[model samples]
Target chain A: MDPQSVERPPSVLLAHRMQGHPVLVVGGGVVAQQRLEKLVPTGARVTLVADHFTAAVEQTALQCPQQVRLVRERYRESHLNLEPYWRLILVCLPSGAANHSDDAKGQSKSESDSEKVYRDAKRVFGAQQSVNVADVPALCDFYFGADTSGCPTGKGEGQLGSMQLLVSSNGVAPRYAALVRDELVRHLGELPLAQSLDRLDELRAAVREEAPGPEMVAVRMDWVCALTDRLGLRGAASMDVQEELKKFKDYCKERGEQVKSPSQDN
Target chain B: MDPQSVERPPSVLLAHRMQGHPVLVVGGGVVAQQRLEKLVPTGARVTLVADHFTAAVEQTALQCPQQVRLVRERYRESHLNLEPYWRLILVCLPSGAANHSDDAKGQSKSESDSEKVYRDAKRVFGAQQSVNVADVPALCDFYFGADTSGCPTGKGEGQLGSMQLLVSSNGVAPRYAALVRDELVRHLGELPLAQSLDRLDELRAAVREEAPGPEMVAVRMDWVCALTDRLGLRGAASMDVQEELKKFKDYCKERGEQVKSPSQDN
Candidate 1:
């Protein structure tokens, strides 16, 4: 049995809602910048510690002063004691020029050197702190997919910040996983994923107003849920909101009766 | 902008690899059981606190005694201070009589009753601890997708445990997301996803052995990456692994020369 395979378990994908939460980043290179790009959207209060930072990192910190705090010095144990303790730590330290050359395939020297560094840092961090170390899978508590394209962007109908689709193979076959992700993203673009959702949300709200009774709650949910199928993927994109609301009002009278008048044992 | 929208920020999807790590799950009904199903696959050491548990939950706990620890009591502050303080806490308490009737849509009586409970629990938990309360989106630090079907099931070609394709709308349009997920799963069924990946992995390993040395590292990676395209999606599934390995060894000689003999006007 491969020791490495045993080290890596299946990844449990989650939606981490880190609004107004303090997070620590321990590097300031392009890799660290990439982590920040993902973190900034979550609205996390990030404190970046590094000897020096890239121009992009400096600009980002300057832009989001309140969201980001910069520490212009090397790392120390005391840095962990920052007033508002950071529960999530992203270690973005340099793992010896990996992309610089193919010598990285040498494996033994580079692997052990970086592995030792990553292992040492993981040990020193607080037991409670979840460390996500870059370049080292074994040391990471969680893996950042680090792709923003999954979240649809743009103004009006195209902007669906909530729409998140992810494809992963737990690093077994990342190339294939990425290929499938691209295919899905293209498929999502053709469909009105955001617009349909927005319409359904509005329709749900409208139905709630029309049927203002507790008894109508299940009816509304079931009705809206059914409507989702009726709308399917494309129908809601071209739906008439006001006309649908009026139509829903008339249909509710009959739908409500159907559920109440249960002819058979449920 | 709606106030609800203000509270609910866009979700950041992360692949959490929680193997042999301690996680706490409060409550032990159907909802907690749902959460346990997701956690069990991650190999997380879970401590579930609840007065009573569902049959499924009890069976799972008994089966994986090493992974799950059950506390037959109501939740207390001290539960947070267990020997290994749980960084991730899942609160799965009953949010009133939801699913019982249409009263769930009242938005006032049941909403406030459950909202207050979720809010109060969120406040009492450790400042650093990330809590995921069932149903209360605002109170949750993170949201459990609570679905494991994304990871392919069964054995042989179908057993792609690593192949995880997730579709989410951040709760904005769950119905639509689910519809798309079902479609993708059906699409995945027809493709030999795991077989191709396994073949590619074997090919890469074989090439690394055939073309040994620091210089061949770049050549090996580039060659394997290019082969991924040549093999494409279905091509690798039907590929002969032994024959392919032999071909890769022969190809290495020509590929190495191409990189070395760079043509330039200069």
Candidate 2:
């Protein structure tokens, strides 16, 4: 009814596989540290670009097993290019009066106005070219969703939980990101299933070389329903045809059978 | 780090909640019926422009609480612009020899390259917008993800179960959609918690107004943990803040205390 009310995609950000992408994360304050807390674990080649660093971020960076490059320098617009290597950027900084200063020379505007100007400058310079502004969706390409790292004792036991990307074509509010995360944390509270997903993934990988047939399909169906029930989802209980092939390896193991993924299936 | 190995988003066509957008859905078969099924529920104004209609679809459309206009006309390029409201188009018609013949005869081609032309035509013009073809991503904005509508009864009584959107930013193969859906279905199997998500949702809605402050937060944290632990999650339970607020309302009703939200906390 309203042209202004265009239906846009949900606010979501990609938690890309850290398999080997170089990602540049700007800023090094508490906010930046929060981003690292979630990013580094994903196996992304994370670089922290900032002149100042917090004790907590420094300490965490030091202990991190993954590649975390911390560069202490005043942020400039020239540093925005991390393409071909990095696919994502995150901007983390305090807003409004808290982000700027008042000089002895003279005052031009109020605290809030200065903060607004500083932020606008950052945007104008394209300093946030790859990064999504914290709490602001109109300036972001994605928003991070809440996710529980996989099980503590299963195949991906210690692996960081699968990151859920909640993208908003309409941009996401930082407050909303937190809300969505909190909501997701509440929604997918099942610990055992999280662990099971890991095991299933492992099982899928483990059984990839065995035989393939109708028996595998049947076993795969069982696991599909098992997962739906485990997650407290009712509609996902029905297993379709192709999914059985992907999980053929895992199902074979559960049934103590063996199967090879056919070239055709791939 | 492999620069070229970046994961590309799969193109997906979302059939849910088109809202009031003008869209065209091609075909009158079961698959078309399925797409329309989710669309109507979400309040999408749908028009099944097909010559043949499945009895199920006709009946379902007849029974839907929402208005789903059905146009029983043979598809034509001219028929496309016939709908005054069509904004987005989805092609789901059956295609092969006979359908291809109609299209081939309808268009003129060079005699020497007839076979090549026909093949190209099938790949291009003949490819239904709904087919999830290799290069059709440009024609779509979303993809149909695997959905577990919601748990109808038990603990997950009022919640939407696990929903997986198999999206391809490049829109290639519907098979991928099927594959991803299968994987999600297999992953969620039947579990006690799956049926209880709805109850959790109910509780969440029930407590929204209650602040997650000391007493309530502590209780919620404990309840979530207790439920997950009793249900097998280690410490991952989160409460529906809103649902908790509803409980507060009930608590207030019983004790004659005024209902206060987090704003009142300060």
Candidate 3:
């Protein structure tokens, strides 16, 4: 067995409500800027602790002072003491050339200090907080895979046909995961995914009102399967909701007899 | 604006390391059982505080006694009092039926107990913890969108080609999000996504070694685009890595002049 095979598998979860949550970010570079962009729309109260800020981070902080707070100071152990408030922590240090430049100049003290900061933060908040250290997968409780298109801002008026697609390799193959994600994003908009969902919701409500029972579970599952098949054949964009609803009603009527078998015997 | 448009947009984050973290789950119904199935593989130390357990949860606890602990009691304020230790909390109480049933029987005490449990949990752990209350979107700090497939067990030999896809609707249309997730899962396995990632990793390393410079980022981006186009035209199964590598070398050699323009000016 490959040694990597011993590692645990990744569990993908979607966190919907992050608004007003306090998030601590330790860095002021391009990566930090990217993270801030993503976090902005979530309305997370972001506190960024870094000695310096990139122009982009400064611009963003200026634009949304209420959402983002920038403290132009180096990281210290005292930061982690805010354990009761910060829900998420992100560390995005410079990598590659910039990281090596410090090493080349024998600035090992700063490097070690940053490392210690990461370690202490994790130790202090590791049990309860979600931490992601950019470019350092081993230390991360979470991994932010490549999101080519920035996270969507929740301004719904112009987003009539917009859909967000998240593809995660659980840090396995981020580059590949990203490539597939971009491709799928292109194909997804053509399909009326949200419309199909609305129609399904309507159909489910109808089903519940007309025939609510123990067998509704199986009946709904079958209906979903059948509807998906039809969508697959004709595509969601052209799905006729009224016709499908009529067809679903008929299908439920037929399954009604079968569903009563065990109950009748009882 | 649609009333739903006022809701916050969903943020999709992938958490990779959940090993041995204390997670509190309050409920033992089908949804809780489903959540357990997903959380089991992450190796999270799960403490389920529910008055009862579904047979599936019971069997799972029996199988993995060390990972999962069942309290066999109702939720209380004390659960949130484990503030320093518990990392994630998930509440999967049946909303309308079980809740109304309590009201019907004048068991307002139990009903209020459940509501208070939720309220207190949020209050005690709101700032630092990750909380998701099923069916009650407003009280949740996060939402668990549908994951039809159980979390993959990372016995990595056969999973060389495996990939995890996470689709979240931010509660806009969960049923739709789930349907799209299921459909995407079906289409995903057919693509040579994993293989492309492996090849890209190799190419990135080669590019870094052979053409190390500021322009390398753009060059690599272009190369990935070209490679993806080729993969789309041919297919991942039939991708000739050696041939692609040679083509990449040639492409780099051809773009060598343009890549050097900025350096030459400097």
Of 2 and 3, the candidate ahead on TM-score is 3
Better of 1 and 2 by TM-score: 1
Instruction: Score residue B199 of candidate 3 by CA lDDT.
Output: 64
- Name the regions of candidate 3 deviating beyond 4 angstroms: A1-8, A79-84, A96-114, A122-126, A147-162, A194-266, B1-6, B79-84, B96-114, B123-126, B151-162, B194-266
Best by TM-score: 1
Q: Which ten residues in a row have the lowest lDDT in candidate 2 chain B?
A: B128-137
True-structure RMSD, every candidate: 8.2, 12.9, 8.4
Q: Give the range where candidate 2 chain A is weakest over 10 consecutive residues by summed lDDT.
A: A167-176
Docking class of 2: incorrect
Instruction: Give per-residue CA lDDT, model 1, range B71-134, as digits (tens).
Output: 9977655566664556577877764433322234534554543343344344554355566776
- For residue A251, model 3's alpha carbon misses the true position, in angstroms, by 14
Ranking by lDDT: 1, 3, 2
> What class would a CAPRI assessor give candidate 1's docking?
acceptable
Model 1 off-target regions past 4 Å? A1-8, A96-126, A146-161, A206-223, A239-266, B1-9, B96-125, B146-161, B203-231, B235-266
Which regions in candidate 2 have their CA more than 4 angstroms from the true location?
A: A1-9, A12-15, A64-66, A82-85, A97-130, A149-191, A211-266, B1-266
Clashes of each: 1, 81, 0
lDDT of 2 by residue, A223-259 (tens): 5445444433222223333454455545555666655
Could you tell me how far off, in angstroms, the CA of residue A92 lies in candidate 3 after the best superposition?
0.8
- Candidate number of the best DockQ: 1
Better of 1 and 2 by DockQ: 1
- Using all chains and alpha carbons, the TM-scores for the candidates as numbered come to 0.74, 0.40, 0.70
Per-model chain A TM: 0.72, 0.55, 0.65
Fraction of true contacts retained by every candidate, in order, equals 0.64, 0.00, 0.47
